[model samples]
Target chain A: MTAERSRLNLRDLLSETAVALTARPARTVLTALGTILGVGALVTTLGLAKTAGNQIVSRFNELEATEVVVSAQSTGFGDNTRSLNVIPWDAQSRLERLNGVTAAGTVSAVDVGDDLARSVPVVDPQGQTEFQIPVMAASPGLFGAVRASLFTGRYFDQGHEDRADPVAVLGPAAAQRLNVTRVDNLPVIFVGDEAFAVVGILADTARRPDLLGAIIIPNQAARDRFELGGVESVEIDVAVGAAELIGAQAPTALAPNNPDQLRVAVPPSPRRVRSDVEGDVNALFLALGGVSLLVGAIGIANVTLVSVLERTGEIGLRRALGATRRHIALQFLTESVALGALAGVLGTSLGVLAVVAVSATREWSPVLDSWLPFAAPVLGAVIGLVAGTYPAWKASSTEPIAALRGVA
Target chain B: MRSLRRSRGAPTPDDLDDGPLEAWAVPTAPAGGLSFEGEAVPVVVLHQAGRTFAGPPPVEALKPTDLVIERGEYVAIVGPSGSGKSTLLHLLGLLDTPTAGSYHLDGIDTVTLSEPERAGVRAARIGFVFQAFHLLAHRSIVENVMLADLYRPGGRDRRRERAVEALVSVGLEHRLDATPATLSGGERQRVAVARALVSEPSLLLADEPTGNLDTATGDQIMALFDDLHGQGLTLAVITHDRSVAARAGRVVGLRDGEVIEDRLVGSGMR
Candidate 1:
């Protein structure tokens, strides 16, 4: 017997593969759809992670890093006589005069003493959803420092503070509680029988969220009415990368004679927060992408198995034509890999288009890794290769004589 | 046409010394065991060849049967249903293995050959035409014929040319680009013949070549086989029809897995 070395003809195999796929066009398309969606989702998630992470890092890198909070430290007195350093009323102006400080404000908590705020004269005991809101006093720059949005007229200014006028700004939650919707109606709320005119309502604040449910008054007005004991803390907004400098110099700026009495708190580094956010986002999206890929692989395997079964006659014919089992296996494997590659190309285009469209609509710069589009196709081919192995084996292992029995 | 190359490590049989390309052109007029040179090497020889189906209880499809088919001999293996004609045809075509005894094709002992070695022998020296005319429906007639050249040892640069020549030989050159679905039954059978001839095999095995055709079309196909046989092509046709068997130079008859009769076509009646 002639023991000839066998080799598969690549051109003929490809032609045969092409004919096989085109013979059942609908099945081919349906099978490819699974891979398309899988690859598209994977590419989309990777692109969005980069885009969203960049925005998050850049957003927090500036203001969040530059922010510093200085608070009063209580000095322990002998025999429980607590002596706390009081922040001066002009501390906002003093800290603002520093080189790197952009905006500063003196924040003091007013002792409301279980007092209820109401738009009407009397507080009914049986009223539903009673409002026992906290009260606080701060300079006008508090609006800019905390990045608060105004729902109405304005914040209390320096003129109001100098005059010690009973002007107040209600938080959005507090305004809702007291039924004060419009400041133009000359709204007034009674704080335990003492009246204060409403000037503005704060919608939201990023830095100071507690202020969203509180009543805010001018420092001078709080001192007059509640005998606001002492300046509580100072909130300072500095220039980018200037938080360290400002924090070091803040205590001296607020209380020059006894700088050691004050304590300064700096915000966390932007790098740490950026890495943490990226890690969480990547893990979540990767899991989703992985699930999609697994589903796609299963779809490929199922369709390939069915194709093998359907082409038993062809496999027999090829074997009769002197094709080895390895040749048959290679043919099927190449077809699957080709299908996967096609899906990869199409899916990547779709994903890129989606990212561009969404980012354009949202006014965000689309950020994607440069190599993703190129590598995604290879990854898809590998998935297809792995998925096709069993089906190819089944196709190759078909008994030649048994297969020919069906033909004749 | 590109000159064919020999396989690297394969043992070359005596007849193949002239190469498969030259084998196609060599005349085969002097019948029986002897070629024109008076060499008595049979193309196919079986020594008690038989096939048993592996079953819950093993069934012997072909009982130890002996047969010999010489070069240039037009032979027909005829039998009724379950007579083991198909089993014998499959063994002769190298499509199956004999469960008992030995088989030699073109001077090569095939009983102990490896799968790939058997396939190599099949590709280089054997051709098959099935009853169903199993043409790939998606391919044009020429492409179907070109399938034979795909397994050739060297790169196939003249496949289109060779396929065209084979189709012309079978009188289907006019339908080169036509798909099998568009062809008539006889024309499809002709395309299958062209595919079988494209490899220039030493022995041509046809299993019920006209089984699916009308009597008139089957007559036409038999005429085509006659023309091929006239050109010195060795043909073995397996059929149940007596008319198909009448055309062969010799007939081997089977009944109940045994060769009941073996005779020249007219000598049995005479």
Candidate 2:
């Protein structure tokens, strides 16, 4: 015959795909469900990982990134004796003068032997009302360095430190133990034979929470009464991104002559911490997404293969109508790809919704990569293509005569 | 004998020319006058064509046989079950290749053609009407007819137009938008006929076209075939029903794996 060659165009392929898929709406939706769940999980897990990682890193940056601790190195003795690294009494002022240092302070524990603290002047020989509370000597700037908030009264100032006053600030635990609730009356507690006036009761400290249970006295008062010697540790609070700088400079600022005798502890870099956390989170979530996607792909493949088997007569008819094997393959492939792309769109929407819903419930800002929504459909299409490969081939290879006879 | 004598005359390109492409037209030189002899080639020519299925002991399905069918002729192949009727039909439709001999359709050697080339030839020159109707149930009558042209090489501009015309010719114009599910058995067969004719193929091969229809519907379909034959189109119908076979101008009867009888019936007019 003087006829043009038989061929199938892209438009016809797409139209045929549409007709085949829409012919059974319920089957189409059921077949696509696997991909939807898979892609949805992928997006949700990835989004949640990013959002939670951001929260953790921001909190870590706030506290760990800004606090630096400088402690005197012990001389490898059995006791808590330091290596003569004298942090001078003016150490707080010296360290605070450095750049990025918000506040600085010195703290030392006073050794009290067989002495107990009591709310009343009588020394209870029965020891029922007497308590053996550890005593702490701290500079006035310690309150600021630790970010402590007061309960009612004010903090002991430099005047009290210089004049060697007996006024004391009780931690919450110490106050409760001593039966002192209000600081407005300036309650006094007797330590051994000394009556120290309670100046303030601390509600909370940001850095060292242990200070909440100890009875804190001025550095000079502790030195004068309890014979306190070398300062134990210096706490310095610096600005964000300045912990390493302040940590390196604080030891020298405290003891310029024997700076080597002081040990500085700086928090790990925020960038490293953030990456480590994100990497762990991404790996775990990506694996979950990958597994779900694999299951989705298998669902597509299994359903497509079953469809091909069920439609052998149709395939045979097409072949008899002058469709080449390639035409048959393309038709089925196009159908599956369309199915996958549709599922991808649905999965992405569901995933984004899940992320937003969870974030809203938890009161967190949702985080998602902008490209995710755009790429998900394409990825789903690719999965469909791969999954449809064998089925399409099976359809294309069906023998026209055998299939028409219903033998295949 | 007249057709055989007339086929010897060399037909010129002018003799091959006809009216503008329509739903039905008797092709003068369907294969573009591929025969260098310049003579009118028969629509089908078989030289010892046969099919055999491989088995522990090979089974000869259709023994080597020779057959010829000329243009504008209506021929019927009838036989009981397992009579090699299906083998001959498959061979003629180009659905199966012959292992014993050669087949030439519309002056072109079919055995040497590649699979894709055979498919192209089938698309352009042969239209098949299955007894089952084989209409796509999900599609409208018009769309089912239009699909006949989907594999044909051409711009899609006039495809729907040709399909509508074919449907109209088959008296299905009013039911263009109706699906096969909504059609009777006879109406569906007519739709199948329209789809087959939409391509304007050189040969129409029907496999028991009335097998799935009632007597009245079968008669109606046969009457449609009579009209198509009156228009000088080539037709080949395979069936086991003697009544259906009696309508064709020529009948070839098969028994087992060989043709047992070939005869003319009715007016035997081409």
Candidate 3:
């Protein structure tokens, strides 16, 4: 008899592995669950990190980087003579004419004693509790610069400022305190015996949230009634990427004669903050994904080892039928790798679906790498190969005689 | 002899009228005295082959024994429990190496061959049928048969054709797509036989071929074995049943790891 060497072709090995794995459908699914969850978690976390980071950076750019504040530097003196009335009356128009500036306005406190500004026409003789609300004055363009939304009625316009109209805009909190909810009836509030008509109620402001609790009157009105002199600060809303240039030009534009008397404050660049936030979010999620993947790998290893033990008879029978040790080991290894690859595909699909579902609910755009789906299955196969090594070796080393005799 | 046959609950040689003895009916040397001249070399040759299990006190499972099986011969290795029958079968199947002595298969020195080489020899030259049927239960009958040639060098279609032919020879052509679980005990054994024959090995080694079957089913399997032997396939069956041993052309009685008897029995017709 010619001595013929035994051989196992790739086609047969794969077919045999397929048969073995598909024979028990339930076990196959159960064995693949860990890998599925691990890969799915990985993809979902990565997608959300990118998508959420983009959302945060865009919002930050809108609120922070687009705003520039120019304040008058107060001279070091107990008296207010030198520091008073330094800003031009045409500060809003002067800054707004700049190329990058969207809207600009000047604001100042009226300097009326806080408790003296009462909502009622007559003070109570019984010494009733009083609301100490601070009153401020702003130009018409301040509302636009601050991105203030109105709850009801309209803002006092340039016409009101030009005529020095005694119209007032109440912040939502101020409106609540003064018991004024609507401007349709033209409700009035007495500030130190001067009745001002409430024209609008502020709903929200994007830049300065502190202004939400104060009462705002037209700058000309504040100047005429309360003798408000110097402008405090000019708020300018510039287009994105234009804040730095406007910050540099605003001080000179507002006080060309005394530019040093004005100080410009532009928001710090958002690039560093965006990167830091993204890095933190990505690192946190990636750690979680890695832990999940490790657990999945452990699960695969455990299941493969158990399967090797359970299929000892099959391994022995193959040996008796001319299978070498390497053939037996390769059969098992290929089975696990196939299982992992199939799980990876399923996990990637599930992860993509999860990202889409979450983004839809939150109204955010989902971001994922184009190659993630293609690479996930390969990652899963590598995990499977690693997990199956010891178990395949164990299978290969089983004694055929003992195994066939049902002794193990 | 009558008392022995009655005690064993099996028929004597005289009770079988299976035609005249064939030319291979004459028994060869009982203990290593045969010469290899110009005749076809024996399919199996064991010279003082033995096996011992390692232990604090090593257990000798099989003593040094000499046996030669020629081509197309039907031999039965019969022994009671704990009589080295399983040990000798393991040795003959090359599932374990002999601790002492030498074994030659088709004139190749098997003892000196590497483990992988031994596996190659076993795959190409030996067919085994176990008492448990040893068929992959999940596979179709034809697929189970085809598994025998999975490690052999051949095209898939050719291997499939040979598998179908082997199944047809075992009268299982109709159950080609049926799983082993769907088959009866005898049909399962027949499928196992088909799987064994798929590789066209020189020697068929069956370990307790009918230990799990009823007497009638066992008889059917033995009849199939007789048919295969008539077609000039060499077979060595290890069984504890006297009736099973009585069906072979020669019987080698083993007791406590020693060969006690070697003699010709049933009509060896071809």
Q: Which candidate is the best by TM-score?
A: 2
lDDT per residue for candidate 1 within A156-251, as digits (tens), equals 899999999998998899999988888998888878877899999987886788898889999999988998878888888888878888999989
The 0-to-1 C-alpha lDDT of every candidate, in the order given, reads 0.81, 0.84, 0.83
Question: Which runs in model 2 stand beyond 4 Å of their true positions?
Answer: A1-5, A60-268, A271-294, B1-37
Give per-residue CA lDDT, model 2, range A39-59, as digits (tens).
988888878877877776767
Model 3 interface CAPRI class:
acceptable
What is the fnat value (0 to 1) for candidate 2? Answer: 0.51
- Positional deviation of residue A331's Cα in model 2 after best superposition, in angstroms: 1.9
Q: Which ten residues in a row have the lowest lDDT in candidate 1 chain B?
A: B1-10
Q: Candidate 3: TM-score?
A: 0.66
Candidate 3 residues A122-230, lDDT tens each? 4658753346677888999999999999999899899999999999998898888777888888788878778889989999898777778888999999889888877
What shift in Å separates residue A152 of candidate 3 from its native position after superposition?
A: 42
DockQ values for all predictions? 0.28, 0.28, 0.25
What is the lDDT ranking, best to worst?
Answer: 2, 3, 1
Tens digits of per-residue lDDT, candidate 3, B47-109, equal 999999998799888999999998879999999888898899888988888999999887778
